[model samples]
Target: MRETREKVQLQPLDHDLAFLDITTEWDLSSSYHDWRPSIAVPATFVPATIPRVIAICNQKGGAGKTTTALELALALIARGLRVRIVDVDDQEASISVWLRYYMDDRPEELRYNLRDLYFNAKVKLSEASYPTDFENLTFIPSFPDLGEVDEKNPVGADTCLQRRLRQGADDVDVTIIDCGPRLGQLTVSALVAADDVIIPVKASSILDMKGVAALQKVVNVVKDTLNPDLRIAAAVLTDFSRSKMTRRIGGSLARAYPDAVILPARTNVKVGEAQLAQQPLRQFAPRETTTLDYDLGARVLFGLGAAA
Candidate 1:
């Protein structure tokens, strides 16, 4: 990815430069004065730690969980890090569907996937890790039938990810799990396996803010009995319009999770087009503000140097 980026003569999009200079006034003008599209960064993130597993989850549908997973994976890949994206969302909208062009080209035979990990103990994580169109970016596809785990929920469903995901993560620099919208055992399994949890909330919905409290309870429970290291590491404000509501939510989250990184991915119309085109937003609309937001997100979360 670094080589590919170097060859392309990367520079900040004109819109991104505009972001560097912005004025604002809002309902919470005094309290939210510190809000910015991108968060501050240091010279580097944590040690180039290998296998820093993260889970992108939100109970609300259309909260940008999958978008957060895919775009952040692409952004990390741009920095030359090996990343694996796991589709734990056993719904129609998993990455398997969005990036079908990249996911559908496997050899003609029975293939292993996330379903096998839940039901078939014989299936190793390596068997399910498949390649995508991008180098150094692996994918673990899931099917709708995998939802049976939620319906039937076999014994020990909660720890399947904790028991399996890390073994496969040994070779990669990061593992990102795209969780289903339901905050059931499946999503709990994701939380159990992660070092960090990124909650992507759509900025337009006040209901989105209400869901955060419910999610916070779940995170506390997961920390107590499951993964003690698990934390709400970041909050992503998706489809940010810089409205008064956006600032309100931003301030609320900052107060709620003082240590977590808060990133605002500005709205872009091309996201759906890229999904329809069967490509990542980073590749389909490299110059869009949303793409750079994801890039800034990946760098900020992983402790990479700030890019111009």
Candidate 2:
């Protein structure tokens, strides 16, 4: 029995099998002079089941950008399709942190199935993947410290996320990039990396129109130079309240972006609570209208059928 145990312990891990060991004793910082060779893994191609990549972006703040992204991801996963999220917003890191907190707090049944992919130049696609409880849901976690990367460089400076994404596409059915509320390099990079862009507009005033226009310009830039295949997949009207003005705004937007999808205007405290608790609305408030809207939005984006 001792020899058998020793043999089993000495067995090497499979080539594709890996795990994380968060050791604190090792020092990561290097002085101006001290240096050592960093570990390198040969780049391996990761084929994607679906070629579509969606970038949830809007130039305006308070557009429910993160919420929209998370909802869409959760909806797709609920449909039994594999989905992964990429956190490109360095400032908030909202989506990634939520996934971590959910994993930390929830029971196994209630836990969100997600993984994380840190945004870094040297980061391999493998380091970004982690398994979760959901069969079809995966996440690419981000860190709050990523905000520091913003201060050091411009927003779109993290351009390599596109390359990394392309390389990792084969592992999942879809990839959703949660972009920050800025048209900097991060947004630009996301646009460049994605095959489609979903613009979320919060119907407040003429400002939303202006925000959409600005986002359109960025999309054009990405199409004209960076990613010609990139196009607007859908424009979602979030926080839609029952009012004459909101109705008018929705009509105008629908007429302008004929291909855009106008989902039901349903917002609730449960949504805010879900985010606070790091849970998706579908999991936190399955019966809420918010879940229905998200499901409808996903159907429109995926062309599964008419709005739910």
Candidate 2's residue-wise lDDT over 133-211, tens digit each? 4555566665555554445564445456677777777788888989888787667777888887777788665687788
Question: What's the lDDT for residue 79 in model 1?
Answer: 79
Poorest stretch of ten by lDDT in candidate 1:
1-10
Note the clash tally of each candidate. Answer: 1, 15
What does each candidate score in C-alpha RMSD? 4.9, 18.6
Clashing pairs in 1: 45-303
Model 1: per-residue Cα lDDT at residue 301:
79
In angstroms, how far off is 3's CA in candidate 1? 25
Worst lDDT window (10 residues) for model 2?
Answer: 1-10
How high is each candidate's TM-score?
0.86, 0.72
Candidate 2 vs. true structure, TM-score: 0.72
| lDDT values for all models | 0.76, 0.62
